[model samples]
Target: MRILIVHNLLWAHYKASVFQALQHLVDQQPDLSIRVLQIARNERSRASLETATDADTPTYTYQYELLFDRFLEDISLTERAQALLRHARAYKPDVINLTGYYDPAQLLLLAWAKLNGIRVVMQNESTAADHQRSGWKELFKRSVFRACDGFFCFGSQSADYLIQLGVPPAKILLRKNAVDNEALRAVYEQTLPNRTRLQQSLHLQTNNFVFVGRLIEVKNLPMLLNAFAEALKRSVNALNWGLILLGDGDQWAELSQQIGSLKLTDRVTLLPGRPWFRVPEVLALSNVLVLPSRSEPWGLVVNEAMVCGLPVIVSERCGCVQDLVHPDETGFVFDPEEPDKLTQLMVKFMDDLVDTQRMAYYAQQYIAPYAPDVVAQEMLDGFREITN
Candidate 1:
């Protein structure tokens, strides 16, 4: 069986890892083979991440074609649609998997696939609570969902959204979104010995809560700052705990100013964004991972942290919270809207109320099912199920 996947970003290392794993499966299985059509090298905003990671050598192994080899924003919609349709026709896949529900370019390909009797599988990331759902958009999404033969969702939240839209539960294939666990864990373990030197050289505290991603407004950085500040005030071990924001965005200046205004200049560290492959190195410098996004699709950083054996303090709104968080076992979850709730969770770690070592163990064990080889096999099985 030939499976064609249409994905937008070439810079997405997490997706690349899964594709690499799937390709490995194809080599062994022989009957199942796949092709990925990557639309662009990177998004304009994430261009910084494309630089100098082991210089010129790719991090993960995968087979894919770069449709544009440029940033997604630089390509015109007409060009995108034409290129996608052209490739879909040439591949003549038995089944085609779309990256998301939106993108008229891919939507047109979806329509073409259904008309030609090629099975369609949707790869979804959006969840019900992450965005404002207007009636017209939801109606459009329903129409899109109706065309697909199967679904591969990011988590329970995304699969639930499809079920709500009238899709049969049997058609939902997978609920796992993954990163290169082996790679991240390797980096984390290798850097563990040098962690003390790294932290001292960077002037970071002995224990810190690390946030890794773009510093945009939707991430709710200001609220995280306020919550962290409040936690500091309430904890006796405040002097030993700190917060690190590791990414850059429009909110960079605003967040920097807020850090000072909150009198958290000494306790908070704002580092520029690094490549996703290097994230576990930063993970080595910190004690826990925190993602307080007001609206997040799946928050893959939570997976990265778990792979590195760090307990996470994720917001309840993140799609990952449903699968990756287990409140006191794997980690804790709280509402992003309430500063006190986040503050209290932070205090648990600071006051040694939560057993970090035990929770870290649970996090690693809990995330095992989301590993690359395991997730790839599930995806391959879904393809076999739908095409049969």
Candidate 2:
């Protein structure tokens, strides 16, 4: 099979999941030819091309300065459409897979592919309720979807969403985001030594609960901070628990202020974002992983945390909650918007940290089947059936 995947690649960090899935496909089927046309972000203008592996897989990066300009959205769309069309003409892939949210460029590319007798697959993280919010973009998206052979979703909820959007039932494939299990396992095994070193360097306690991801509005950092504060105030042994906030975003200053206002400076610590490779170590060091996202399409980090054997507390709004989290069995699921409920869950986890570790063990066992290779195989099977 010759496949072409279309998606934006900003510094190659964003496409790790896709690369993992495709790499698995290449490894399993050596006859497969895969080409990626990565649309570089503005900051990657002078970025050097780096090969991910020694394999014969060819990745081509195209520089587009105006790909993310808000004022020149139409121009950017046209530019991306032209670039994809040029690549399609040259590569002529057997199947073209489109990932990410609905956009004009994606619609145009799908239309062009359909006109050229190419099989098209659209993969997105949105549910049906979310699709209705797209308004006019939904119409364009539907048009492109109608021309496609199949649709791929991250979970059953998303697959059901596409079905509700009137896509045929057989066309929806539920494939979760792929993770490198071996790499994760290796990281987990090596994390104890690294965690001790990091603890000594940062002077962090061993019982701290960690929250990662961007500190944005949808992430519900304020509610998390409030919840942590409330938990600390109510706990009989406040000194036994600590909080670590990882990653940085637009809400950093406000979140920092909230922590200070709540007098949680001693209990809660804010850490800057680290490289993707170091995330497993961070997860290993923490006693629990909290993802209080208000509206996350799919929380891949939740899977990563669970794979690292950390108990997770994710919001029901998170897509991964449906698949990865099983309240009391694997981890807990709380409402992201309900700070009080989040606080209660946090307090409950802190009170039962040993039980949480047992839950973390179950989480690792439960998520074993959804690893990268398994997901890639499922994807390949779907594509083969769709194209047949």
Candidate 3:
């Protein structure tokens, strides 16, 4: 059995870890072969997330091919489609796993695979709450979902969306998203000793609620800032806590202005987005992770935070909230629209209402099941079930 997996970006370390494990599993099967076709090295919006990985040029050792040695946006749709079709025809795969429905090229490949009687597994991350669902897009996605033989999703929320879009529950192969937990844990543990010094050097408070991602409007940064300010006002241990925004985006100027107006300029610090590997360094100095996005698909940063032994305060809208967060046990989930709810949750941490150390332990324990090895095993099983 020859399997071709089409992916959009090559710089995703989490996906790379899963693929590496999948490749290892496939290697044990003498008659099975799996290869990935990465459309581009990285997306433009996520260029800052790229880090200086180890000796491996691709960051992970996996059997894969790169369609273009550039970002997908730089290439035209025609170019992408032609290259994908050319590669698909050459590989002549019996089964194909498509990245998602957004990419026209991959959708075209899905169509071709169906016409050629090839099995197709669709991977999706979008949730019903992530954005305003369009009737036309839903109609198109329903058609695509109906045509695919199996589905892999980010989490329960994504799987639920697929089911709502007309996919059968049995066909929902996997509903897990993960990071390279071991790698992240190692990096965080190694940097643990320097965390205090690093925080001092950066003038960060003893306890910080860190938000790491682009400063895009969809991230709901303004609301996060407002909630953090309120939390600080309500904080009894005022000297130790602060908010750290570890990303740069188009909203920098606006966010800066809001920080000043809220009188949180001293309490809030804005840092540029760093590479993926170096994230552990930031995570080491932080007490908690906060993702207050109005629209988040899966929020992989939550996984990263949990792997680093930090409890997360995630928005209810994030796809991972249901699967990863345990409502004040692992961490708290708040409605993004209710800034006051976020404020109260943050206050729980600041006022010593919740045991941070215990919650961190719980987070690590809860996240164990979402490891790449586990997800890869599910993927392998899904492939076997569909092909059989």
Candidate 4:
């Protein structure tokens, strides 16, 4: 089978699970010939063109003059339609998989694939209406769904949403996002012995919890910070616990100001975003992982943290919370907006008397089935069904 992957690739940062799954599929199936075509704006042309490919894989890239200053004006329909038509003719792929949010390129590719009798698989972070509010945008997005052969959603909610958008239920595949288990295992094996040393180096006490993701309003960081502060105040051993925040975003200044006003500067540490490769090391050094997002399509990082053998506390709003977390089994789920609820879960998680090693063991066991290889095989099976 010859497959082509069309998606946006910026800064050579393809840490997304979909990309990892595609790469894993290519590596495992000898009979599958895979190629990736990255679409970038004119400004990213130099960097995108200069990217080097691994010698072991068959890959190619194409760049065009699509440019826009803001998110809403990124690409015009005609330009994207033309690009999709050109790339489809040039690559002549048997199966085309498109990943990303709703965009002109995605819609055009789906329509062109339908016209050409090519198998089209559309994978998005989540449902269209869940992310966008405009009526026109929802209508446009529904049209895009009509053109694809199959739809792959990162969670069951997303699949249900697609069905609500008029997509046939049978055409939607519910495949949870996964982790690169091999990379995670390698990093864990190398860093497991240095956990205590790394924690000490960072000045984190044994009870510190870690939060990783862009520090933004949608992530509900302010609520989380408040809940953490409340939890610390309620605990008798408040002096021993702290919170470590990873990643930066537009909400940094506001969050910093709130933390300062609340006198939480000493209890919270803000770390800048690290490369994707170093994330496992960071996860291993932390005692627990917390994701408090107001609305999350699927929290891929939750899966990654669980695979790294770290207990997680995610909000019920996050789609991945249902698939990855089994309340009090592998991790706990709370309402992100409710500080009291989150604080209660945090307090319970911290006070649990069970062996930490056993908790980590359970976390690993729960997440192992969603490894990249297994997810990729499922994706391949979906593609086969679509193509046949």
User: Compared with the true structure, what per-residue lDDT tens digits does model 2 show for residues 326-366?
Assistant: 88878888877688988888888767644875786798898
Candidate 3 collision pairs: none
In candidate 1 the C-alpha lDDT for residue 103 amounts to: 88
Candidate 4's displacement at residue 29, Å, is: 6.5
Q: Highest TM-score among the candidates is held by which one?
A: 1
The order by descending lDDT is: 1, 3, 2, 4
Candidate 4 on 1-388: residue-level lDDT in tens? 7787775543334234545566666767787766666555223322222334454222323232222332223556776567666867887888888875466667667667778878888886674323655678668778777877887778776787778788898897545667666666677668879878887887767677889888777898988889998988777667877788988677889889988988988878888776555677777767789998878888878877887888888888787866788876788888765789988877775665435677789888988878755776777788778877
Alpha-carbon lDDT, every model: 0.91, 0.72, 0.90, 0.72
Give lDDT: candidate 4, residue 364.
Answer: 88
In candidate 1, how many Å is residue 18 off?
0.5
Q: List TM-scores for all candidates, in order.
A: 0.97, 0.86, 0.96, 0.84
Model 1 worst lDDT window (10 residues): 52-61
Runs in model 1 deviating more than 4 A are 53-58
Model 1, 8-35: lDDT tens digits are: 9988888888899999999887677789
Model 3, residue 39: C-alpha shift (Å): 1.0
Error of 3 at 237 (Å): 0.8
Residue pairs with backbone atoms closer than 3 Å in model 4 (clashes) = none
User: Which lDDT tens digits does candidate 3 get at residues 1-388?
Assistant: 8989999888877899999989888998999998899999999877767767566223667799988998778988998999999999999998899998888888899889999999999999999999899878899889889999999999999999999998999999999998888888888999999988998899899999999998998999999998988888888887789899998889999999999999987789999887777788899989999999988999999999998889899999999998999987889988999999999988888988998889889989999988988998999899889999
Error of 3 at 278 (Å): 0.7
